[model samples]
Target: MESTSLQPASAPAGKFLSRFLIITVTICILISPGYIFFSERGGIGFIEGVTVKQLLHLIFPFFGLYAFTLVWGQIIIGTCKPLIKKIFPGIGRFHRLEGIFAFIFALIHPVLLIGSLGAVTYLKYEFVGPNKKIFVLLGVTALLLLIVTVTTALLMRLPWLQKRWKKLHYANYAVFILVFIHSWNLGTDIQGSPLQYLWMFFAVSAGLGTLYRIWRAIVKRRTAMSAQSATASEPTNSLNPPNS
Candidate 1:
């Protein structure tokens, strides 16, 4: 019998675009509940004659765009083997691509959002807004974090700074926290709906929960190894039968 041949997969030009669309569709689908709930009576939607909500809703897509970079960033960085490995030597290429996405979101988030907050608020508070100052702080912090993250990403593009780049990229942990705060607790969105708050709370908790799960696994593995080591050494002690 002839062996079944494995098919070779070639990378296509539109592959990234397809993957992006798929992820965008998935997130929009997942967040539909929040969108519907916000639309009916929950979010800024209920206000009569208020055009601000409409404009703000238009700006919302950037949130999804920024969020996409975040989830993808975690995947690219977390799943890869340690940076020292030569097989995947093009770390700089991936890093640059991530930076380009990040900066695109960074630029778009503000430009699209600036009009939504209206004339007075936009002028007074700037990129994020006035009433949502805390959220703005979080957003700015996330921006700064992205700046560092992107800086390291670009730094990885160069051999001169490659050694220190990984260390700087570790700042992404802090960046993730700022991003979660900005995303979860941003402005009146959370204040208006208890269910919305609950959703955000759980989403943030899920990130922490994932980290906790990883930590627990590491601890358990270490404990088991320690126990095995002790057991292995015990036999040698018994055979030697050393005087106390």
Candidate 2:
């Protein structure tokens, strides 16, 4: 069957441009929190007023937000793709790429933060600190879950594991929730700034998409059950009629 859907071949350059715009937008959103915080530094000399460590402390969450946004984007796309496929047939194709990008930023987030705080100090504070223990624990757990999600996404193409891949992919949503809690509570940058608004926007957007996906799945299952019940209750044709 010949396909009628639009293909990148028809506008290869336009396709590349579209991808570029998407990535650029993602970068802008990711950098927004850190940029706004830094800009609020008023009259202080950019480099002299805030040491590199201080700057990194302000910026690490931005990188983390980047990864979290990508993860949420994947969830939204995965959930909404079926409904919107007619308008944007290739939208779902970005899910794997989004996962990879999420993993990369997720890695950068910790590495920068760990660099800013020496490994021993960061570990002690994260694990045994009096006040921030729970927040750190959630963040670390989210990181581990993110690893599993990315690994599953990478291996999902294998024929042997294709069927189980989606069940495992659900971890991404859990990671998203954990990361949000970790940021909202512990991130000073996120607490009072415009960044909080951005975070809330993504949270609500992803939440609605998730709810729609769940509702659609429930409706589909109920429909299947009704069809099965109707089939089973139907009268069977008999070879011998009863005194017809």
Query: For residues 1-244, what per-residue lDDT tens digits would candidate 1 score against the true structure?
Result: 2333322232343455555674686476446545644564547545556577566655564353345344445533443324212333555565467666766666566555666666576556664546667866767676777677777776576887778876786666666666656666653444455535444544554466556646766988999999999999998888995689
Residue pairs with clashing backbones, model 2: none
lDDT of each: 0.58, 0.78
The number of the candidate with the highest lDDT is 2
Tell me, what's the RMSD of every candidate? 9.0, 6.1
Least well predicted 10-residue stretch by lDDT in candidate 2: 1-10
Per-residue lDDT, model 2, residue 103, is 89
Task: Give the clash count for each candidate.
Answer: 0, 0
